[model samples]
Target: MKIIQKHELNSLKRSVDQGTEEQREAVKKIIHDVKQRGDAAVQSYTKQFDRVDLEELRVSEDEMDAAYESIDGEFIEILQEAEQNIRRFHERQRTNSWFEPAADGSILGQKITAIDAAGIYVPGGTAAYPSSVFMNVIPAQVAGVERIVMTTPPGKDGNVPEGVLVAAKLLGVHEVYKVGGAQAIAALAYGTESLQPVDKITGPGNVFVALAKREVFGDVDIDMIAGPSEIAVLADDSAKANEVAADLLSQAEHDARSSSVLVTTSRELAEKVEEQIETQLKDLPRYEIARASIDDYGAIIICEEMDEAIAVINEIAAEHLEIMTKDPFGDMAKVKHAGAIFLGPYSSEPVGDYFAGPNHVLPTSGTARFSSPLSVDDFTKKSSIISYSEQALKSNGGKISQFARLEGLEAHARAIETRKERWK
Candidate 1:
């Protein structure tokens, strides 16, 4: 880890990807081909990209059952508990369709309604992410979405990960398809012979997937274009160097581009954590990836005071922040930006990633400054409701007409004025 003074904070901020013209053109071609040939194009791309030939796109109930059976009992038990926690947490986010009526019989309100269906694209080239299934599906289910469709690339052997299937089975999300990359996003946005289109899509994938989401956005809603994982730890002299180093590595091991940062008031603690990061990297299964990430992206900033440390933290606006100070809550009160904050040493970042109820699909890069995490709200839409009685309209019609006319929308003014005929 490169230890630097707080003046070098500019090096920490990275720009969001706009994707290359070649990638954009490639995605456009893929989407257009999927639209023209439907299932045939999807299958062809699946064979070309995933290296698997799929006679069928949808996963059957028997296959899901077999996947459930394949997993051991203890892991299933853990998944069940995590699902319950997630469901319980998200159910609290469920809002009702509310209308407030005035004495004049005018009602103004908001109507909250879930979309008809959602598409979840889980990346399948590397490791199986059962957590993605849990984090994405449970929120949509809680939002009262009628149907949920999932798509992932099939392995060379023509099988999705057993753990992923098991998680979907537990949640009753049976409408899964064997597709990946831009084509899968295209299929979800526009219907095929076997797969129906969804109103919204959520989940993370590769750069091609992110570009595909950007390409298909107007046709269907998408979750954020997630960057690589990152974690920033704010610690005092009291925090254990080894534990903080381990927490940072948890995110670094995810991708070679992942960044792990530490901002601290103690120079001694910073040097100790630097040593611990190197020592622990030797043991990680994905050591090369972690090593590259730590060397290229990771850093530690030495701040003389707590206020300076907090300032650096807000500037970074990390995806995950762990406050390991003696007064974690006190220090956290000053934090203006962070996708998710893990307080105390015991509340590590992974606890929120897999087991805890909060959604793991969070805004990455510096997006936490203005954006939010995946939640029930992302799965639902709201419609404004307005009903004005005769008396109410008579009171406000003139002002409304004038306001419309002020905008130079004469048609709008006339439309509002035409209702006056009944009063005359």
Candidate 2:
């Protein structure tokens, strides 16, 4: 990993910005073709891109049943444990549609209701993220979403991952489609004959899928236009350098474009962490990917002071931020931006990625500056509820009419005037 001083803000945006125009246009064209040709276009793209031939686009219940038999009982039990934690966390976020009434006979509140359906995209070419299915679906399920549709590309042998199918069965996904890439997004955004459209779609994908979601934002709701995964570790003298190195390597292995940074006032600790990463990389399965990521996007910034490190972290607003200082809480209070903050040495990013109650589908790049981690609220809508009784309208009707007339809306003023006659 490259080591830099505290003065390199200008070169940062190059690392974290969204896709180029050419990439975005490619995604847009795919969406256009899917909109016009529907399922045939999706099938063609699946064959050309994934090199898979499929007779049916949706995964059948028999497939899910087969997956149950193929997967081990132990792994299925772990998925269930993760599901319980996720459900318990999101259940707290469930809210009632409430109305407040006054003695004057006025009513006001918000009606909280879940969306009709939700679409979840699971990447399938290189990796299968069954954990993603649990993370994305459980929150919508807790919010009382009626139809939860899932999409993932099938393998070259025309089979979805056993773990992915097992997760769908565990969550009772309304449907599973054997489609992936930007076309899957387009299919979800604009329904075809076989697959039904959904109110909102949530999950992480590659640059193509991210651009597809960006293109179809107005057509349907997306969780966020995610970028590559990222991790920023703020460690000091108290932190164990080996643990910090392991935590950084975890995110680095995600992709060649992934970023991992270490900021510390302890020069000794920074160098130790760097050395440990080099030693640990040799044993990792995805060491090549992690090495390039660390070389291209990773950094160790040795700051003269803790305040300076905090400033740099806020500027980056990484997807995952870990504080391993003496007083982690005190340091966290000063933090202004981060999709999720992990405190102490054991609270690594992967914990949040898998078994932790929080959703792992977070804002990537520097989007944590404005975006938020996925939550149950993402699947629900709020409508303002208001009512007024005759007596209440009579007491306040004159002011309402006057304000409407002042705004030159005579129709609004007349409506209030006509109601006032009944009270008089």
TM-score of each: 0.98, 0.96
lDDT of 1 by residue, 228-279 (tens): 9999999999999999999999999998888899999999999999999999
Candidate 2, residues 1-424, lDDT tens digits: the string is 7788667744444344468999888888999999899889999998998898776899988889999999989998899999998889888988889999999989989999999999999988678899999989999998989999999988888889999999999988849999999999999999988888998989988888888888889989989877788899998999998999999999989988888999998989988998999999999999899998888888999888889899999988999999999989999999999999999988988999889898888887788889898999999999999898887888888899999999999999999899756755
What would the TM-score be for candidate 1 when compared with the true structure? 0.98
Taking all chains together, the TM-score of candidate 2 against the true structure is 0.96
* Candidate 1 C-alpha RMSD relative to the actual structure: 1.1
lDDT of each: 0.92, 0.89
List CA RMSD, all candidates. 1.1, 1.6
User: Which ranges in model 1 have alpha carbons more than 4 Å from their true place?
Assistant: none
